[model samples]
Target: MIYKYFKECKKLIVLITLLGMLIGMLFFITKDTPPTLVLKKKKINIEYGQTYYANFKGLVDTTGMSKKEICYLKKNVSITDNLQNEDQKSYPAVGKYKIFIKYNNKLSTIQIICKDTLAPVLAFPKNVDVIKESDLESIDFKSLIIATDLSPLKEIQIDTSQIDIHRIGEYQVKVFVEDIYKNRREKEFKVNVTENKQETTNSQNNQENNVNKIESENNKPNEDITISQSNEKNNVKDHLDNGHQQTKPPQMVYWYECYLCGLYVDSNVSLEDAKKKFDQTKCTDAIEFSGIEWRHSRFHYGINHS
Candidate 1:
């Protein structure tokens, strides 16, 4: 009886060991193959202020299996679950970030590439200087010289102190410039100061000649010209009768022109102020019209008409 009992106990122990092994194997088979994650779009490039989302789909042979715990493979990436799909996950961000999925302690690795999306900004131009026709006469230049910066791209303003004002001509210049992206830009313009070369040259020469003439006039002797007494008295009476009377002494026909103005110093224009209507250029023709008769002749301008 003792020998038979020992033999039966050894058979029962062997059967229990085999059953334990089978149960362990079954547990491992279910746990080893986790659900697979399928990513729809893995790479994204976006701007700083933009919004986006990462989409995905997943599946498994969990025909009779149930998910124990769902977790994220990555901690930083934001994940949103959509109950509509069998396996659902989404990640979105304006900047670059990574994401992953986990089911039942098994995780799917994350491989994502995100790009930056921001544009550089340009600053308002300053230090403006006007470019006139005279500048073009010396060379070629445009309407203005303006200073610009992209200090908004602070690194690009490497030579901030070097910005300067320059003039080349009326219609062209090399502008010192910087763009929003720190790019250097130069612009040119075309503006005509004068249409005719002859007129420009003549006007320039006339200005120079006038300066020389003034200098020479200063060196010349002051004339001791004296009018005959009879001429003076008659001229004085003629102006007085024509209403040249004033708080001060009556005007004299020094060069046959109104003293206050360069108009004809005659009797008929007594009604006009005569003081304001005269140009100094016409004053130089004083000697020819010194006589009342010639001064009274209707004035005709231009060498062609003369």
Candidate 2:
């Protein structure tokens, strides 16, 4: 019986040794292996104020990755940048940046460029009246233009080829501006070369003299009193015989002023019709008329009657 027990113990030892070897082989075969990471793009450009995501699928290639490995990488990937904030989706300012991405002990780098694509905004009057013979070269074109941009301006150019300072006419002036990021914008306005100062003053004085002469004539008293009194008596007798007095027709006049050219116009049409006529008769694209005023006068001093 003792000999039989010894043989059984030896068999038990051999079985236990085989079982341990099988367990060790299974553990070695099932161990996890590191994945190979490949960067698809090394440089990325994002517009100003654009949102950035932490997704690496577009920037990285993971062809043979299983669903579980992908999920693991998504949860464990890290991104670091100089301008990036933990709670922000984009950079705070416009400039060049470097982004570092790390996943599963593999490190990669990429360039993130924040670019400004919006053009500058320019604000100025649509019409500018410059006197004839004025020194156009002495004018500061930059000071007259109000430009707003997200970045510093590279250059501001004024195209005055269409303008003739020596002549009295309307001309177009264009302004072209560009930012540091190569964003460009252009705007145009009218430059009216008005009459010389001396000529304008002489014309105004002559107009004033004519107006004074008309006023004097209206205020003058009748010269032949006896004839005037006889005609007045006859007119009263005729009116009494007719049993009714004749009434003069009502006259309606509308007055409008051109804000751009500083010219006044008198019209016999309604106010709305007068405005429409004035707009239709505008010679320049920048000429704008003010609101019309109703008047009963047949003659205006500085107004062009129509």
TM-score top scorer: 2
Q: In candidate 1, which residue pairs get closer than 3 Å at backbone N, Cα or C atoms, i.e. clash?
A: 47-117, 54-91, 140-168, 140-169, 141-169, 141-170, 141-171, 141-172
> Per-residue CA lDDT of candidate 2, range 1-306, in tens?
999999999999999999999999988865565445677788888766443443455565777888876666657777666656223322346777777888777778888887778787666555555556656776555555666554678768999889888887878889999998889999997766665444555576668768886544444332321112223221211111333232222344555465444445566654434444444443332412122232211111211221
Q: Write the per-residue lDDT of candidate 1 for residues 1-306, one digit (tens) a residue.
A: 999999999999999999999999999996775444444444434432222333322222223324441232122223442212111212233233555545445554444443322333222212222222232232212222223221233333222122222432233323444544445544433222222233445576668768887444444332212212223221111112333221222232212243323355322232122222322234433334113221211131111100
Using lDDT, give the best candidate's number.
2
TM for every model, in the order presented, reads: 0.26, 0.47
Which ranges of candidate 1 are over 4 A from the true structure?
A: 1-35, 41-43, 57-96, 111-114, 121-129, 132-152, 155-306
TM-score of 1: 0.26
Instruction: Provide the global lDDT of candidate 2 against the true structure.
Output: 0.58
Clashes (backbone N, CA, C under 3 Å), per candidate, total 8, 0
lDDT (C-alpha, whole model) for all candidates: 0.33, 0.58
> RMSD per prediction, one decimal?
34.2, 23.7
Alpha carbon deviation, residue 85, candidate 1 (Å) = 28
Clashing residue pairs for model 2? none
lDDT of 2 at 111: 86
